[model samples]
Target: MIPIDLQILKYIFMEKPIYYFKMKPYFQTSEYHDLCMYITNRSDTQNSDRLDKRDYTVFDLETTGFLPEIGHEILSIGAVRMNGNSEKLDEMHQLIKPIRPVPNHILSLTNLSRDALNQAPSFLEGFQRFLTFSENSTLVAHPAHFDVRFLRAMVKRWKLPEYSPPCIDSQQMAKYALPDVSHRLDPLLHYFNIHSLERHHALNDANMTADLFSELLLIMKKEHNITTYSVLQQLLNRQKS
Candidate 1:
């Protein structure tokens, strides 16, 4: 056998053992400190940036049924992205195949059936396309709570991350902007003289919603000079509160 020191040297050279040690509390604490610093910096950056009015992707969905649970699913989604100037940027209309069969009542209501959606894409696929088409813009919908709830459930079902962007509800906005008149879409559309070529269809409803939003904005600007996103957000928050 070799000398002890020599044997030790041979073992060190041959094995090159990696000694694992628990990180000390101080070192582990610094990781949290670093994360906090990162978050602070990010928040500061976000706060320092100037806010601008953004385009909105107005959308509507026709579903197999009213309830999100109990196997109700979206049959079609229609969307149109409108710029700050109220010009349409991109549009999408897609049919979705529901996991459950379309009931006869629903089929009659939406004119969508199992056979009609046989070749259509799934909700996950269609929603992904809508996200891409929307392109970081805000979402607009009439009676938004209803549509948002359905969309949120669908997004959760597909394991999609939460949507962080803002959403504008023309219904509530109209309540604030035109309190004197009925807030229903049809009546509001008629009030603004917005023609609805087709009713109940997702695309046509989305188009009508987009038009109504534009008209409402114009009326707000002309009457109240409300033209900023921050102001709109504040007003919406106040209404909610």
Candidate 2:
């Protein structure tokens, strides 16, 4: 027979498992229908001919889990509007209440509380406000795959309007521009000598990403002559291949 304390430990672990982070993807058959079409059908009018002349909305999200299909939800969004590589036009930050309670680890990581989130607006209201702030600017985010995927998941779940902005992944941009260095935000921040923001805060991260992307834009223009959205896409694709 097991010791009493060991038995209790086993029962606790078995009854209430803690997911420190999600590793497995939660696949959905509808993802292709719900998410892929948005990418496929992005409006050509939204793509700016010149990178240096374009307007962009650089954004970030704090979420409860990695995969949205498994009930993971967005906790907050942070974004900034920029004109080309030089001018920052505006900023936006919003907290969204999830259907489930915020986990202890997430609360610690984000400096957010269940009480605060409980008082916040639902994802629909907050995201709608963000869309208004974003307008029709090109969407920019570090690791666009994660943030955009989460946003698309929410859009699908909420039956919101199709998100049609041309999206750019700043992380991929960094990887293409500086193929030698680490592309994670912290190392890139250090590499570019950009000042660090409070990590895990959505707005701060967005601001940092915007700054990093601006630097990258200048580099791409001067070194690679990547002047247009089409050229930028081609460069990124070549890097992937």
Candidate 3:
């Protein structure tokens, strides 16, 4: 008959018990298990840090006018995603047809005439495409309030649920990151050494915003150590309050 100690050891090793055996030996008698355990624990801690990365989408809208209450509508919407460290992913851009005619003043500003929008889909269709492309990612915009207001209005008109995704306003970020300077997009781009190409186009503006946001995120990460979504949300709430 097997010795009682050996039998207990065999049962602990071979029974495949329901609960984990923390005291079980993990290495051969000739090897050290403490080093292995330390390595495993360190790997787990590193993986936990990696899991806290952030995801964001930088976007821009070219509108037919300024105020939504005064019948302004979005003419085009463009966006690009960024992973934890501000690495950009694929981009999305769509031209939208407004419910009302494009005014001469808007045409002069945006250079998008009625004929250009004639071939495009309606605002609802364009917004649906944009939403699908975004895949529920957090949004970043230069002046978030205007773009968010327009998007919220479109969603409401289409009877869709409200979009409550996390948002980062580059304008606000600029104010916080560079307290002494003007917070306009062009100036911020210049400060970050991001070149501005097509000034008023939706896609170009979106790309520029992405670059600016990337630089701003690097700054935030280095200075504030903002590595998690909850921390970012708290900072934004504090800014709002």
Q: For this target, which candidate reaches the highest TM-score against the unseen true structure?
A: 2
Q: What lDDT score is found at residue 7 in candidate 3?
A: 51
Provide TM-scores for the models.
0.76, 0.80, 0.75
| lDDT per residue as tens, model 2, 150-189 | 8987776555456656788899999988989999999999
Candidate 3 accuracy as TM-score: 0.75
For model 3, what is the alpha-carbon lDDT of residue 1?
Answer: 48
Residue 153, model 2: Cα distance from true site in angstroms: 1.0
Q: Clashing residue pairs in candidate 1, if any?
A: none
Per-candidate RMSD vs. true structure?
A: 18.8, 8.1, 23.2
Candidate 2, run of 10 with poorest lDDT: 18-27
Cα TM-score of candidate 2: 0.80
Number of backbone clashes in candidate 3: 0
Tens digits of per-residue lDDT for model 1, 119-238: 897665676577667755778899888888888876554444554446778898899988999999999989989987677789999999999999888877788778776677788789
lDDT of 3 by residue, 123-142 (tens): 64676577666654677898
